[model samples]
Target chain A: MSGGKLITGFAVTATSHTLGEYRARGGYQALERALLGMKPEEVTGEITASGLQGRGGAAFPVGRKWSVIRPDDGETHYLCANADEGEPGTFKDRWVLENAPHLLLEAMLIASYALGVRHSFVYIRGEFDLAYRRLAGAVEEAYGAGLFGKDIFGSGFSCDVFVVRGAGSYVCGEASALITSIEGKKGYPRNRPPRLTVRGLYQKPTVINNVETLANIPWIIAHGAQAYRTFGTTKSPGTRLVSVSGHVTRPGVYEVEHGYPVGRFIHEDCGGVLGGRALKAVIPGGISTKVLTASEIEPHRLGHFGDCEDRRVLPQSAGIPHLEPLVFEGESLQAAGSSLGSGGMIVIAEGTCMVRVLQVMLRFYHHESCGQCTPCREGMGWLHRIVDRIVSGRGRPEDVDRLYEISRANDGTTICGLGDAAGYATVGILDKFRCEFEYFIAHGRSRYDGCLECLGSS
Target chain B: MKHLIPECEALKARLPQGFESTLVLPCLRRVQEERGYVADGDIDALAQYLGVPRVQIEEVLSFYTQFRRQPIGRWHLQACHNVSCSLRGAGSLLDRLRERLGIEPGQTTPDGRFTLSTVECLGSCGTAPVLVVNEVYHESMTPEKLDALLEGLE
Candidate 1:
């Protein structure tokens, strides 16, 4: 097995975030090992070999991203950790920042060395109060120990880490917009013919990785890539820090291996849905990815999208675990028409209204649209207005089709993923729960009480 | 606004080389830190101090939602009305604050003790129903808890 767990394998005391405590738990060894022993190509090669996927919603492989920037490319490259954890339900990166910040700093240093980056930056969100303080404090500590500055570990490779905080803009979490924010401009996302890896921050080659994605680099470097691959499934190859909220009984961050069943994670690890009510739906990631109904998540047990539920037929099904009901990792969930995005699972209970849920989701997309593209800017507001009127007792049967039309309009029409993502969440909910929207539009009110809270069954 | 000269100078002295444009957000943060909000006079002085145009400063504060132009009350209550928080009674939570303060969102109380506004997300979804009073976060808040929080503020 790998030396320590992927991240957060240490006993977290009150002072564990300190450099001394971190070193005691073997924290900066990955950077030291990579700097003194391995070449830059080898460091990135280990990451590529490990198959570590990006934890920021999109499951892009981390290795493919690093490969874009050649170490000997003869250009000033930048490394950025997107610490703006603005996705509504995702706060796993904040866990690494508040309690395990040195892990991130050390990981960024390893990545910087690999990418030939002289200077790197972390564009943290402005609203992150404690995470900012802890990260800044860790950076100061790393500098004090000579771990960050000139000739780190006497490898003759030098890099500096800068914490450039954002001023409460969600779109800045996007790589291009984040670089733009760092350049001290309005946080509007730019067109991307030149990927950030090609012409990025200051018009130079830059590599931006999500905080959790970068946090895994030290582990991959410390242990060989082959050892790292042993942790999760062949494709996913690591544990994801799932931040569950909403109606879960015990809601917080739990590190689930990629092949771990989603049902077990929610039911056992998270203490099941709140008030012990029947499960209604789960927003598998943030409000961006598709929402999975209870049956969809437990598709093998009760067939929603045509997986065998009959006991006689289930025994013959080869890869499908009918008895266990496995919805493991990204591909498994994607098969159920959703993605394990950013590992943010918001569990919705039986009594919750889908219209109210979509209204909240639409309102978020509308408020956070950055207004860079006309499709997203107009489509988001239009989607929100339609849902708002439906919740406000204005009955129109045409509204559901209009919602679908608006969602269809947003697909691939915007510069950033926010537009397309908002559409995914809307269509996902609408696809699963069309009757609720239709009922609300026809009757000018929600079929249920519009209750999101789980008042326990009497 | 004239009292913010020292803060502006401090911001100017610390900006990274050739990245004077980066001073935009930090400068606005500084002004808001000194004064309760970024007034028009403060923006003019900041633009002049940092040598960034007034338009850049204007677009900045206008873009980021946290930076307020007008002066707000002592206790700025930001209730998260996003999915997780909304699922956990953030709607009624906002309603309760409105009843207690006798002011809707974007309005301050008659005495200027409280100002209410709904934020998109505070990222504390685990402890849903989050309410941010100034910089601190009050998570999984109830109407009773909010009432107590308001009482203790004075």
Candidate 2:
């Protein structure tokens, strides 16, 4: 399908079946166009105009990120694509890597040209063997095509990309932690000050872009600034791959123009909830964000869309948020104390227990906690135990208040976002679903039908 | 025998001179990359070169999932048994492999052609119920595909 048109190239086709298919579909035509004539700044400007942003949860502008890496540093600059997609309910990057490997490679090459980087790495999650292999194969294909190594498109700019596997650690999704893992060290996050763009990966200036962020580069370069900014709202522009899973009939990745309505995407694109079950709640941006109930999604107020002025142009401000009864215009879902994280929209169906869901999420955080900070290490385990007790038919009215206190203490004290994830779940569930939790505690079972079964299986 | 004795003697020269904590893992990794498994004396030499006690290196080799202390088969098949993969039938895949190979999780075939092991998360939860054979990932595995894959490998 011709999803969109490229300025310097032909139509952007979705022939992402294989590497050869991608090439035939005019996948790396932008990179060839770029190497033939386009200057580095020209590419960066085009991306900036396109309003592309990091797709690995933090929606930072891609153009701004490229502009930050000064060429005068004279040190080897690294382009690390954060493919460690650990966010629950998010599977878009994997699909891209598996299907459209060349797109990512082409984007990385263009990004390297912009940043004057010679070496790059695709930091894929260790478990994503398919993505890792596909990326590795794509790199080899690029090398064979003379798109990488020594000289690219006969332009003196030489770049080599490697795919590095990360041992299963969610914290490695953080740039510093990723760098540490690449350096063969334990994947622990470093406090930000020098920032990754300034001093990262062997203490040299580095730019860490998300998989989708890099994938957007070729599109930006091929489509001029004005052409790329034709879609989405004024601030956020461009199309994004939204990964919607859980309780939806048509759960999969959907590539939509920015500013697309959440209700439209969910009801139309996803075929609505399975069995026509009413939506009970939704976690808009992955599992970390606060949960919003069905009432919140009815009016479509809380959904996140790319802010843009022009029609048909999409920008980097693309995000995932639950559609609420409110109109989503200027205000951000994050302003409501929940972020549109990684475009992982998990829908909670009617008869699904919210407290049980929170308990499951809490258990995940507890297991994944790196134990670097005292609060996260200790607090997560404590929360898990308390929730376990409650779920096992043990009751204490004060436990709800205790859960809030524990989550509050762990929120800002951790070395990474894991603490926040645990804390957010704790606070969100307690505040929004307290009655359900209380009912469960009082009756030693869930108030919702089949909730006990859900708890048992979950 | 004389050459071996002299090399052993050179170990004394190597032991104290610029002695550093040897990364036996890297050496073992290199050896495995080239030969697929550690040889008899490679471990001892690596220990001597690293200047750490042999048992320490052995403990490290045994601790991590990547390093295999003993000889493995030609193909190392590790099925991820973590939550995500488990939720998607990774355990069943393991069982299928075990039934076919006639061995348990850590056992190698008598012919030394394949070894089965269950690992923690391999990070591809999006494509659950995955396995890695000689570091090549096979995703969304079904019983039929597993049988075909095993047969092809053999």
Best by lDDT: 1
Off by over 4 Å in 1: A1-4, A302-326, A455-458, B1-16
lDDT of 1 by residue, A20-108 (tens): 99999898998889998999999989999999999988889899999998999788898889999899899899999999999999999
Best by TM-score: 1
- In angstroms and one decimal each, the interface RMSD of every candidate reads 1.8, 7.4
Tens-place lDDT per residue, model 2, B44-137, is 7766655667776565454334655467898888886644454355657887999999999888999999999876545444455678898788
lDDT of 1 by residue, B1-154 (tens): 5565675555444333566677677767767877888888887876776677889888888899889888899999999999888877788899899888899999998888888999987789988889999888898899999889999987
Candidates, DockQ: 0.67, 0.12
Q: TM-score of model 1 relative to the true fold?
A: 0.93
The positional error of residue A395 in candidate 2, measured at the CA in angstroms, is 3.4
Candidate 2: C-alpha lDDT: 0.68
lDDT of 2 by residue, A1-458 (tens): 21332321233355454567777877789898988888887777777767776777768878788888865467667788889888766777887787777888888888888888877777788666667677888777777878777777778888877666664677778888888766545567888788888889777789998887777777667767677778555666666676776666666666766566566667777787656766666777777777765545554543322111121231222222333442222234554456566777766666766666776677777777777899999999989888888888896888888898999998778768789787886787666667777777888876665241111122
Give lDDT: candidate 2, residue A393.
81
Worst 10 residues of 2 chain A by lDDT: A306-315
Tell me each candidate's RMSD, in Å, in order. Answer: 4.0, 8.9
